[model samples]
Target: MKKFLMLLLALLTVMVIAACTANEDAGEDPTDSEEPDTTEEGTNDDDEDATDDGTEEKVLRLNNGIEPSSLDPSIGFDAVSWDPLNNLMEGLTRLDQDSRAAEGVAESWDISDDGLTYTFHLREDVNWSNGDPVVAEDFVFAWKYMLDPETASPAAFLGYFIEGAEAFNSGEGSADDVNITAVDEKTLEVVLEAPTGFFLDLLTNPAFFPINHQVAQDNPNWHTEAESFVGNGPFKLESWEHDVEMVFTKNEHYWDADTVKLDKVHFAMVNDSNTQYQMFESGELDTASIPPELSDELIDGDNVFIGDYGGLEFYRFNITEEPFHNKNIRKAFAYAVNRADIAEYVVKNGVEPAYGFVSPGFTSPTGSDFRDENGDLVTFNPELAQQYLEDGMAEEGYNELPEIVLTYNTSDSNKAVAEALQSMFNEHLGVEVTLENQEWNVFAEAQQNLELQFSRSSFINDYSDPVNFLESFVTDSYMNRTGFSSAEYDELIEKGKSETDEEQRWEYLYEAERMLAEEMIAMPIRYYNTVVLEADGVSGILRHPVGYFDLKFADKN
Candidate 1:
C-alpha cells in the first residue's frame, strides 16, 4: 500500500509539471501579467544523467539573489527568507498545486458562518525534525510571540486580522486578550475582529507558522545555525555557512516524506544575477534567474520560463524629509518618469506599466478587478512635471531644489533602472538626482528603517487580496516606512475590511487606491514578471503568483 501511494504521488507530480511545461510552451503563466516569455524556438536535449554506484543522485543546485535576512519565521519577511522558509516550515494552510489554500500542518479546518471564527484540525503524524510532535500549542506560542512587542516582527501587522492582535502588538492590551487559542493538542481556534474574506489565504504567510517554543527558549539564535535549526516541512537544514551557502536534505520525519522525491537541494548566495546565469551556463547551477538584458540572448532551448509574479516596483519618497515633504514635489517626481519607456526598454521582461500601487489582476469578490475600476490614475507629462516642480519650489519658498539622492540595491537590472530614472529626472524635471547602490541586505535594512531619502521599492503580494497591498500604508504598519499617513486613508481600509457587502467593500478599497494615487505618496513603476532559466531535467518546481518558487515536488531526471 505504501509503495502504491508513493507511485501515485510520483505520477501526480509528473502531471503537474507537465501542465506547467505546457503553459510555458504556450507562453502562458499565472503571474497575472499578460506578456509572454521570450523563448528559443527549438527543442533542447534532456540533461545527461550521471550514475554513481549504479544510481543517479537527485541533487539540485540553485542560486539565491541575496542572503536571507532571517530564518526565524517571525522575523523574516522578504523573498530571501521566504524562498527557504517555503521549504523549512509548514503553516496551517499552504499554496497548493493550483495556488489555492491547501492542507499543511492542519489537515482540515472549518469556518463559522459569521466568518469571524476558524478552527483547524492538525495532522497526528507531523513532527519537527527534532522528533518533537508538532501540536496546537506551538502555533499559539508563535502567534503570541509575533504579537509580543519584544519580538518586533516587522510582519506583526499581518496578525491584525485576529480580534485583539493589533491591540496586543501595539502594547495596548495583554497577550491573553489576543484571540488565538489552542483548544487541545490537535485543535486550534482563531477569532477575527470581523469577517475577512481572505483570512485563510493569509495563513499561507510565514508569520502564522508554528514555532517550537522550547527550542526558541533554549536557543535564541537557533535559526542562525544549522545545528539548531528545527523544521517540520519536507526538507530540513543540513548546513548553512552564513551569506555563502546553505544545503537542505529531505526530512524522513515529514508527514508526506514518501512523496518527497529529491534527496537534497543546494543553495549558493550568488547575489549577482549575471554571475548566477554564467554559473548556470557553465553547468555549475541547475537553476538561476536571468537579468533583463540577457533574457533574449540566454534562452538555449526549453528551460526558460516567464511568470507575472504579481509584484509592483515603485519609488518611495521620505515624506518627513525636506523637498519630498512638499506634495507637489512628490507629484512632480511621479509625472517626470515615463513608466511605458521603462517597461519596454529597461524591464524588457514581460512586465506591465503600473499606474497605481495595487497591481492589476487583484479581483474583488464580484470578480471585478480593482485596477480596472481605477484606470491610469497617474501619467507622464514632462510639461506638467516641470510646472509641478515650480509649484513645489514656490510652496517651499526655494529658488532651486537641493540635490536628491535615489538609492537602490546592487544588481544589473536595478542599476539600469536607477540610471534610467536619473536621466529622466535630469531631462524632464531638470532636477539632478544622484544614485547610490548598496548590497541587498544593507539596502533592505535601510529601506525598512526609512534611513534613505528616496529609494527603489517593490511589494509582492503576501496574499492575492487587495488588502495585502492596501494595509501596507496604514499608519501603524511597519511596512509603511514612508511616514505618509492619513486618517481618511485608514478609515477607508477599515471600512473595506469590515464591509460584508462584496461590492461595497471593493468600493472602499478603490477609494483608498485613488486617494493614494492623487496624493502621489509613492511613484509606481512597473508590475513584475518572474523570468528564469532552469535545466531541462528539473521538473515539478512551483512558482507562486506572489513571486516565490517551491521545491517540495521537484525532481531531477
Candidate 2:
C-alpha cells in the first residue's frame, strides 16, 4: 500500500511539465504576472477586514459550481459536496499534504496479526462544533446509518469490506449482525471480512465521517441547516443561504485548531465557468476553475496551477433500454467517439485521452502503470464503428436504429462535451443523437433510478488502489449506473478482493479492465486534470489527485 505515494510524485511531475509547456507555447514569462504593480493606490480589500486587535482576518473565497445535493456525509458523494464536507467533518483518518492517510480523530490504532480486526483509540480532547464530546458511538452510528437499507446511501458499497456490511445493506441481515463495536468511550473495534491492503486509505473518504449520534436523533435534518449541523473538523457551518452561498467559520473547539490559519471560508454557488472566472478577476472569488475558452490564455499566468486529477469523464449506456441493449451497438458507439479530439478541442485542459476506465498513475507490484500495461482497448475507428452499427441493426431486426437521446447535467463544459459527442455519432455512424440537460440533483437521482437511456457521468477514485475503479461495475454495485450484469465480471472482482498475492491480484484487475472495454458498457472521454487560477497572496491549499481539497492550513494575505 505504501506504493500509493508514488502517484503523488507522478502528479507533481505532471504539474511542472504542464506549467513549463504552457509557458513555452505562449512565449510569455509567467513571472511577469508575479511582479507587484506599484501603481495601485489603496490597500487591498482583504486588508480592510481586520480583527479588533489590528490583526488581519484571514479568509478564503471559492466557488462550489452548484448547490451540493446534500450535506449529509453519507448522501453527498459527488465532488461538489465532497470538497466542503472534507473540511467540515473528518473520519478516523485524513489525507495529509503528502496524500497519505494520517491520524485524525484516531490518535492511535492496533491491528491484529491476521489483519482482519482493527482497534482505534480516539483523541479524548476532540469535540464537535456544538461543544459535545466526540465518542466512539458516533462512528458506530454513522457507519450503521450509511449501511442501513433505509438510508439508501450511494456510498454504501465502500463499506462492504466490513464484516456483514454487504448483507445488511442488501437486506439479508440485521444491523446487529455488523461487526463494528464501541469497545469503550474512546476505543472502537471493527472486523473485516478479508485483509484489505488499502483499508486505511478508504477511511479517508467523507463517507466514513462520524455523525453526532444524539444530535441526529433529535433532529433528523441536522445536516440541512447551519444551526443544527454538528461537525468536529477544522471548520464549522456558520451560515447557509440555500443555493446562494455558504459561510464556514473556524472551529475553535477543533483538536487541531491551533494549526488552522484561516478565519473563515466563503463558497459561492456559481454554475457557469465564465461567471466564475469573472468573479475571480473581480476579487469576489479567491479561486476558480479556468474556463475552457480562456484556458490557453490564462494557463500561463503565474497564479494558474495545474495538477493530475484521478478521475474519468465518461458516458453511461443503459443496457436495459432499446438499441443499447445490443452489445454490438454499445461497442459501435464507444468506438465512434474521438477521445483525443474532444480532450484537446472541447475540454482544452491538459488532460489525457482515456481509452480505458482506470486512469494512469497506479503503480503495480512489478513497477508498471496499470493503464500502460493494459494498453489502449478502445479507439476512434469510423469503419469498424459503422460495421458494428450495421451488425447490431441486423441483430435487432431493424432497418433503422431507434431514436436515441443523450442527457447530461447542466454546465458549460458538460454541454460542450455532449455537443461534441452528438457530432461524432452523426459523422461516424450517421446516427442523429438528441441531447438533453437537467440540474445536477435531478439528473443524479434520475441516473441512479436507471431512468436515463444514455447519460453523461464521472467517477473519482474513492481510494488509491486500481481495484477501487474496477469494483464499481460489480453486479449490484451502486456506482454501476449502467444496467450491465455479467457473472464472469462479478467473479473476477470478488477474487481480486480476497487474493493476497500482489501479482495475482493485479492480474485479476487487469483482466477486469479489458472485459469492461470489450463489453463497452461505458464510453471513456478523457482523464481529469486540475486547472485552476488562485488569487495572489494565497497559498498552502492542498488538492490531492485522488482526494478532495484540504484547506485546514490555507492562508490568505
Candidate 3:
C-alpha cells in the first residue's frame, strides 16, 4: 500500500510539471523577442504590450524631421509641408473631404450683411493639451502677436486681409491695431478689408489656428523642441530626435480619442531613398515615400503600394535684382530646364510633366484653365530662350555675360536636377550658371529673405485651390521669393476675387495666369504625384494633398 501511494504522488508531480511548461510556451509575447525575459513574471516577447490575459495594446510609428517652425499659427505659417502642426492644431474651422470649409473648433459661424465683418463660434468642450480651456483669447493673442512686426513672423501676410493688418505688418501700426475681439467667451468677431471667400478656408489653416496663448508665451521655442509643445489633435508628440527618430502618443485629452486608433507611433527620419526602401523591404516600416526613381521594385506588389498624389516641383528665380530682374532672363532660364528628362529618368512613372503653373487635377471653385488659350503645355525651346537672353542682356546694357547663381537643396536628387539645368543653360543658352548648395532649413531661410538666385523650388500647396498656387506670388505674399510684382497681376487677382460671376472670376484668373506665364515671372515646371510606400498592418492613415500624413489614425497589428 505504501509503495503504491508513493508512485501515485510521483505521477501527479510529473503531470503538474508538464502543464507548467505548456503554459510558458503558449503564452509568448511579441516584444520579448527583442529582449530577454528578465521580469519577475517571465512574460513572453509579444506580451510586453499585452495584459496577462493576452489582450494587446495599440501603438504606431511615424518618422518626421525637425520641430515645427513656429507655434504661433498666425505668424509663422506654412504648415502645408509640415502638416502635423495644421493637423494637430484645431482652427476656428476645418476643411471637409470636398475641400470646402467646414466646422472644426468652431461649431458654426455667421457673417454680417456688410461683407466685411466675420464672426466665429467656438466649441464649448475644447481643451488644450495641458487641460486649459481653449477660448477666444487664444486666437486674439495669436493674431496680435503675429501681426506685431516685432514678432518677425515669416507668415505675416496671412494677417493682410484683416482691417489694419497691412499697416500693422508693414510696421505702421502696432499689432494691437489689428482689431479682433471676443463679444463674450464663446463668440469672436473679426473685421476684414473686404468680403473674401477664401477667408474661411484661410481660417482652417494653421496660420489662423488658436494657440494656448500662455503656453506659447511661456515656451517661445515650443515648436523647435518636441517636449515643449502640446497638440489638440488625436496625438501628442511623445519624443523627437532631430534627423533621427520621432514618436507620438495618442492624446487622451483629445476631443475625439475614441477614433484615435494608435496608442503610440514611432518615426525614423531616413535621408537616403535607398535606405528608406530597405526599411520597407525588411517590413520594419509600414510606409516609405520615395521619388519615382526608386519605385520600380514596388511596381510588382501593386497590392502593397500606391503612387499617384498631386504636388508641383519647379525652379524659382530671384527676380528682385541683377540679371534675373529682367523678364526675358527669367524666361530664358525656364526654357533651359528639361523637366521631362527629370520625371522620366529621375522620378519614375505616374507623375506627369508640369507644363503650366497649376497642376491638372488640382482645382478650386475658381476655374483651372491655367494653361494657354491654345490648350497647349509650355514648351522648352532653346532658340527662343537664347533670344530672350540676348534681348534681356541688350536691354540691361550689358555687353558682357553675367554669371548667374542657382541655389538648390543638397540632396542627391535635387543636386542631380540642378546639374541637368546647369548643363542645359550653359550648353544652349550661352549663360554661365553657378551652382550653390545648402541644407533645406537654410534654403528656406534664404528663400524667405530672397537671398537665393534661381532656387530649386517646389512646395506642396497649402490648399488645393489655383489661388493657393497662383496667389503665392501675389505682391507681398509670404511665399513670393521672386519679389516680382505686377500691377496687372494685382488687378486681375482682385477682380477674380471680387467678381460675383463664376465665369468672370475664371476669366480674370486665366488672364492673370497667362500673363504670369508669358512674362515668366516665376517658372512653372511639372506637377508630381506624391509617391508613398505602404506596409501591411498599418491602416486608417490619411495623406493630405500637401504631402503630409497623420499616423494618429494608423494602428499596428
Total residue pair clashes for candidate 2: 0
Give the lDDT ranking, best first: 2, 1, 3
Q: Which predicted model would earn the best lDDT?
A: 2
Q: Which stretches of candidate 2 lie over 4 Å from their true place?
A: 1-48
Q: TM per model?
A: 0.89, 0.91, 0.82
lDDT of 2 by residue, 1-557 (tens): 12222432453354335433331111110000001000000011242367778887787887665566678999887676787889999999999989999999999899999999999999999999989999999999999999999999988988999999999999999899899999998999999999988899999999999999999999989999998899999999999887667888899999999999999888776655555566677787788777666667787989877876787888899999999999999999999988887787667767789998898989999999999999998999989999899999999998998899999876556767787788788878889999998865677679878999999887778889988878988988888889899999999998888788889999999999999998888988888877778888888888877747888888888
Q: Which candidate is the best by TM-score?
A: 2
Residue 236 in model 1: lDDT: 97
Residue-level lDDT of model 3, residues 1-557, one tens digit each, is: 24323433453354335333422112111101001110000000111265347776664434332233344455444332245565467778766644466777788888989778889888888777778878899888877777787877665666777988879878798766787887877888999877676788777666677778788878867666677877676667777665455666677787767877766666554444444454555565656655334346554565344533445667777878688888888888887666676565555545567777766654434434444332543577878888888898899998966678888755545555566667677667767788988765677778778988777676555554455566777787766778878777888887776676656676787777777788776676566554555666766665545334454455667
- lDDT per model, in order? 0.77, 0.81, 0.62
Once superposed on the true structure, which residue ranges of model 3 sit more than 4 Å away at CA?
1-54, 65-67, 71-81, 97-99, 303-311, 362-377, 394-400, 430-432
Compare candidates 1 and 3 on TM-score and give the better one. 1
lDDT of 1 by residue, 1-557 (tens): 24323433453354335433322112111111111122111111134344456676677887654457788888877777777888988899888888888999999999999999999999999999999999999999999998899999877888988999989999999999998888999999999999988888899987788998789889888888899999998899998887667888889899989988888778776654445555677677887775555545654447777765777888889888888999999999999988887786666656788888888878776776878877888888888998899999999998888779999766546666787788788878878899998865577668768788898878878888887787788896777778888999999999978899988988998899899888887899998766677877888888888656678888978
Which residue runs does candidate 1 get wrong by more than 4 Å? 1-54, 299-301
